[model samples]
Target: MDPVARQTLLAAMDAGWADPRRLYAEASTARRLLDQAREVLAQGLGVRPSEVAFAPDGPTAVRWAMEGLLHAARRRGARTVASAVEHSAVLAPGRHRATTAGDPSLFVEVPVQPSGALDLPAWNAALQVPGTVAAALQQANGEVGTMQPLEDAWDACRRAGVPLVVDAQACLGRTGAPTSYDVLAGDAQSWAGPGGLGILVVPEGTRWALPGPPDPDGALSGPTRHTPWVPLALAAAEAWQQTGATLDADAREATALVDALRAAAAALPDTEVVGDPVDRLPHIVTFSALYADGEAIVREFDRRGFAVASGSACTASTLEPSHVLAAMGALTHGNVRVTLPLLRVAGGRSEDVARFAEAIPAVVAAVRAEVGAPRW
Candidate 1:
């Protein structure tokens, strides 16, 4: 973590640690702080704090979002569509289960451009499918870091009378993109907030389907009198306010780095960077080196004191090609995903990044030399 981020966390932790549920002055402080957090977050996301419901974490937030969308749109029927580049939660095959007569409920696969934008033609066609209740897509790709055209997609779904659910897990607050989604989900950890807190931004007046006693008409799940919910909301909001315009800066610098690396690797005979070159998210880049092990290069970089990420970080177990690249008909098995930390020193603007960029050719050369990529 960056030093400034760390300091912010420590301060937020100290101030937000008080349980807002307690019936005392400390509790009152916590409640006020938490309320302030939600308001701040709403300001950053261009929504209302009342619309933002905090969850325990990101995956849970996703589950709640999917199921809530299902319930909210249940009156329509059991059809859910998600972009092919959607996260695992939305891409779950279970959502497309077999029904009576052996025909499965439709789980339409809408294609997104390599740059992570919605495929308008496919989206238009998919929404026209009868019984289509809701659609899900990440606000941006986590692995590839491409921002989706949620505004346009949301508009299309609206025109088609379909509700849109977005997992803003990686892009929320970071990108500052406009969202009019029925359900927008994300986590605090994605933006340096404490773990165990997730966000489901549900605007007021939107109907949501939740599984439970139905005590309250709004909010995602759990009781309103919960502890830490208020604090986490407040902290997340404050963090967002302090980190405004981050998306543009991160996107710009990361895009430049991607271009730098892509050019450097292009000099090699059998190397290719994946994802859309432009109109993509600015913070992430992935590439595949033919015949060269992804882990080997990542490890080599780590050894040199530069911390970067690889596609499907669990490469040692399954060297399978990245699903995103595979979907694009591009290389996958030997792919690396570099996510630049918001702090510039983490290879964003300093020598750390320049050195990493400079080291690419040598790493590719060394790996290719060992595995014999190609002579030309």
Candidate 2:
């Protein structure tokens, strides 16, 4: 769905364009408006305003949060753990092992089912390993819309004394992070905010070590007295508030669309819909047509004027299926992701999803025909 919130954001930006950190009266007004935004975020997410800090975008937030967890591990011991479903930004840094020559690093990944949620048995086994450190999990799947058993898995981490780092990039404003996690990270763009904005929230009393370009004074990214990046500050607040109000409606529309799409998908000879059929996000659908190159289908739909995402939209062009989908051990290489937004009053209607659903058959059919799949 198209978003009207863009207009709202543009207008807000026009009005509050002054630098929020400036000492002058105009900047002071921007700063005051930012405070209310932070309070809204705190209220919406059930955390204090001090816990949230804004970053450039989702990947940046993911990196920052992972770094904090890694620093926490260094303070306590020397091991780090995560899941197979983690985003690339989180997994890449954790792969390097420090040795006697340096600080060796090692990683253990909890497996997931083909539907993309965590594999409970595999997870329990991984966390039980000796010298287990922090664990990372995503609240929702950007590729498949499957939700990990976060509260349960996070409770396991807590019981094992392993701090849990969560990627809430797809969950913030839709399904806010569960409070049990040690570190929370997400991008604002997924929720219709500006592209270059993300949030990293550290709860009080978490032994996170953040020594970097943004935070070196033993404080968060913002200075001790004031914060920077107030537009993100405002985005977080407004998006969450708007999401809470329209979640049910959006979910209702998306569910029906998914049901229809799943029925249409099943007609294919060797294809399957991945992710939980129930208990998942309302906004996304992921499926794989066996033996079809994902890029081919992506191009077919792109020509059809349907803007679909292949894997996580932002990270897909790296010539790999999402780690989340790969971790699920499903049909990874030939998958497509469909997303619906919490649109504004005039932006989209149920018929739009239906039309998109109707278009999918033609798109897939064209792709299959082009690939020489037998027309049965």
Candidate 3:
């Protein structure tokens, strides 16, 4: 979290400790804070305050958003169309829903180009499928940082009479909120806010419903089964304000740094830098080195005092091959993913990226040498 956001969070802990559902004075104060937080987030996202709903986290927000759309459209069609490179949160639930319904065709996974951009023709064709009730495409690929053709996809979905749910968790604060989505999902953590807070926007007139049975308190459609923690909401609001204030400047610097890192990685022997170089996230870069183990590369980078990630960005803890890379026909092994922090945040500066770029060639060589892999 940003230092200022952290202080705001800590201060909120004292001010918003009461449950907002109660009718006490402290509860009223907490309720006011929560409402204020929603307004802040809505303003930042360019949506109405009534359109916004909170979630426990980003993945949950995505899953709920997709499921809600699917449920609402169930009478019209049972199918959901999404790009193959969608985050696991979107893909996993989609697959599960298809499996549970005993219909493989219920979820259609459209392919992407090698640059990790969705295949526009394939996407349009998928939406044209008879049973597609909803379509999903991220504003940007979380794993490789490739920007999707959101406007085109939105137009296609509109023509097909399908609602589009955009997972903008990766682009929210870093790039800016996307305007093309019928339903937009984002994470507070993406903008220097604390984790455990997710944002969902459902514009007025969008066909959406809570996926499960009705809640007595009508709370299931909101952040959690109950009211969200007031302190976290306030902290997220503060983070959004702070991050948005410096977004343009921070993105400019991060773009230059990421470009340098991409060049360094691309220059390494047998290494392939993935994603669209110019039409991608400003702060993320991923590269794969042939014949090198991803974990070994991560460890080598860690030993050199730089934290990095490998395998699937969403499922890194499981060390699974990246489905995103596989969909893009890119090497999945020995991959290193870097997401630069905002320049205003600690350990986020030009110097940090420079040091990491300086070490890339040696790190790749050292890892490949240990694995006894040819560098050709």
Winning candidate number (lDDT): 3
Backbone clashes under 3 angstroms, per model:
5, 6, 1
Candidate 2 local Cα displacement, residue 375, angstroms: 8.2
What is the lDDT for 281 in model 3? 93
lDDT by residue for model 2 (1-376), tens: 1144455466668666677656898787777767777677667668887776666778878877777766656745556677777787777777755333264435766677777778877777777776666778888877778888888988788777888878888876555446768888887766555577777777887877555454442232341222546655565567666666776676677677777777777676777888888878877788877656677778877887667777632336676657776677677755778877666533664667677667766676666677677645
Candidate with better lDDT, 1 vs 2: 2
State, as a TM-score between 0 and 1, how close model 3 is to the true structure.
Answer: 0.95
C-alpha lDDT of all candidate models, in order:
0.69, 0.70, 0.86
lDDT (Cα, tens digit) per residue for candidate 1, span 310-363: 664247456555556656666665566776666522444545567877888787
Give the Cα-based TM-score of candidate 1 against the true structure: 0.86
What RMSD does each model have against the real structure?
3.3, 3.5, 2.1
User: Cα RMSD for candidate 1?
Assistant: 3.3
**Model 3 lDDT tens row, 239-275:** 9999999999889988999999999998887889999
Q: Which candidate's TM-score is highest?
A: 3
Which run of 10 residues does model 2 get worst, by summed lDDT?
217-226
**Per-model TM-score versus the true fold:** 0.86, 0.87, 0.95
lDDT of 1: 0.69
